[model samples]
Target: MTAKEIFDSTIKEIEPLYGNDEARSIAFSLLEHIGIMKTAVLAHQPMETDTSILQKWIERLKKYEPLQYILGETSFYKRTFRVNSSVLIPRPETEELMEWIIRDFGSVEEDFSEKPAVTIMDIGTGSACIAVTLAKEIAESEVFAMDISEEALKIAKENALRNNANISFLKQDILHDFIFQTPLDIVVSNPPYVTENEKSAMQANVLNYEPHLALFVPNEKPQLFYQRIATFAKKYLKPTGVCYLELNANLAHQTAELFDKEGFTEIIIKKDLSGNNRMLRAAL
Candidate 1:
């Protein structure tokens, strides 16, 4: 079949399950993967072919598999990240959060010293996106990351190595008793903040394909992770240390209130590009 024909056929099949735009993206992605072109002019040229592999991919997509998982890689912070069901796919807003961090700390090298030696901890570091990005961007920052899932940690470690970033990985459940051996200058997280009650409103690709443990909390205690992390920051973060979190937009006020009650000053609630209250920054 011609590239256009193949893409159109695929899009028709998936548009009902996903949406037209996403289905088109998937169609073009598959065509590009196999070197198919919209024009027969390109088809006349010798192109790579592995029909069996392509068919397998199509089958997976038909079942609503995320493209990142089917391909086993994603891009975050302009860098390629290895991702699977073991890790949460890095989102664009998280990249913006990293941008904020980079902007705030970029001048510290000249202001303080060549190697300022700041320490950061990432709680629930699924794919280690935040930890690795900070370690790569910061001049002299020591980064530590933790996750409760051993499977998730394995993927995160591979991602850190893939990015050529240095990060200390810990296999500890943040919900359980775990303490930082060293003081931290910054604490950051994009923890699971979605509530059980919110699941019905989520997309099927997300609700079905993504890990529930990394995406949700019981509706009865939606702020559980935020409270725990804030309490930990109070004890472990330095006096001037900063805490940042990617929050549930619907619960931004509640999340901000947690920090206020926890005695964190300068609490700032920032919206993502979509104008959703998506990130929070506070100083202890």
Candidate 2:
């Protein structure tokens, strides 16, 4: 078959399962991967040829594999980063988190007298998206990251190298580690905030395909990671340092309360494009 035929066939087969737009996205991505641009694929004549690439992706999609993982890369903040089952696919909302950090820290770079190096630590830094993005944008900030999952850390480290981002990756269980090598200028995290009770509400693609360690927290203690990370930030963050979080909408108020109780003054909760409570930033 020609590339156009293959793309159409793939889209038809997967549309029933993933809907029209996502199916089209999957088809176009596969065609692109095989060196067939949309224009070229459309114009090419039909031919008797193998269609294994489309079939393989369809099979994976049937099992609920995320397209980003199937494609092996995803766009975030105008840059591409490798993604897989080992790490959560970077999302546009997370890009907003990076933008927020840059807006807050980029101004600090303007000081020329005894310019202090800002240190940033990303807790549960899956795929190192935030850390690498910050390091790339801020230029002089010292970025460090930690994750308990070895598989996730591996992918994160690879992404850091691929992006040429100077971030120090350490395999640490944040629940256990409370001290930092040095005081941090900011502590940011996009931790697992999806509570067990909310899993049934997640889309099938996310529920079945995304890594649970990076997506969920126990229902019994939904805000456990946030509490731990905030308390740690209190201990480790510089007096003027800030803590930023990409939070669960359901618990935005509670998450802010947690920070307030922890004595993080000047807490601010911000919503995503969807207008659900999505992120929190606070200063010590």
Candidate 3:
């Protein structure tokens, strides 16, 4: 088949499940990634592909597997992130959170003679996207990331290396062993906030393919991650430290209130590009 033929087939196969526009975008993205042009999709060109790999991708798409998983990577903050079942796929909203951090404390650099170096910790760091991005963008900041999953940490570490972002990764479960002796200049996270009751409304591509451990919490205790992170911030964050978190859009108020009750000052609930209250910032 020609590039057009494969592209058409890919979109046609995925459209009913994902949507016409989104399916077309995915099809085009895959083709572009493999350097397959619509005109050259056919085996007429030496570069054209008619491999079984195409069929396998179609089969995976039918199963509601994310295109990122199929491609084994996704773009976040204009950087490529390796993703799989072990780690939550990086999202655009998370990129906005990273951008906010970069904007507020680019380099977090001090004169060194007058003040101490900046220190940052990312709790529940999944693929290390936040940790790596901060390390790469804030050269003078010391970055540390903690995640519960060993498998996830493997991918996170590799992502840090691939991006050449020097970050320290620790296999510590935030729920139980959360501890930091050093005063933190900043603490940030995009923790599990999707409750079990909300799962029914989510798409299968997310519900089936994404790691639930990193995406969800029990229905009865929806704000557990926020509460825990808030407590952690209260303990470790310096009086001048800032805390940035990606909150569940629907529960933005509750998440921000957690910080408020924790005595964090200047608590701010910020909306994403989509106008959803998706980010929260506060200071100790």
RMSD of each: 2.5, 2.1, 2.6
Error in Å for residue 75 of model 2: 1.3
Q: Work out the TM-score per prediction.
A: 0.91, 0.94, 0.91
Residue 29 displacement in candidate 3 (angstroms): 2.1
Q: How many steric clashes does model 1 contain?
A: 0
Give one digit per residue, the lDDT tens place, for model 1 in 109-205.
5454655588999999998888888998877888999999999899899989988988999998878877578889899999999998888999877
Which ten contiguous residues of candidate 3 have the minimum total lDDT? 106-115
Per-residue error (Å), model 1, residue 194: 1.0
Stretches of candidate 1 off by over 4 Å are: 1-9, 35-48, 107-112
* 27-46: candidate 3 lDDT, tens digit per residue: 87788767786556545444
RMSD of 2: 2.1
- Model 2, range 1-284, lDDT digits (tens) per residue? 68677778888888998899988877888878766778866786564556677578778888888888888899888778998887888888888888888888784356534667889999998889898888888746899999999999998989899998888988888888655678999999999989888988889878887899888889899999998998789899999999999999899999999999999899999989889889999999
Relative to the unseen true structure, what is the Cα RMSD of model 1? 2.5
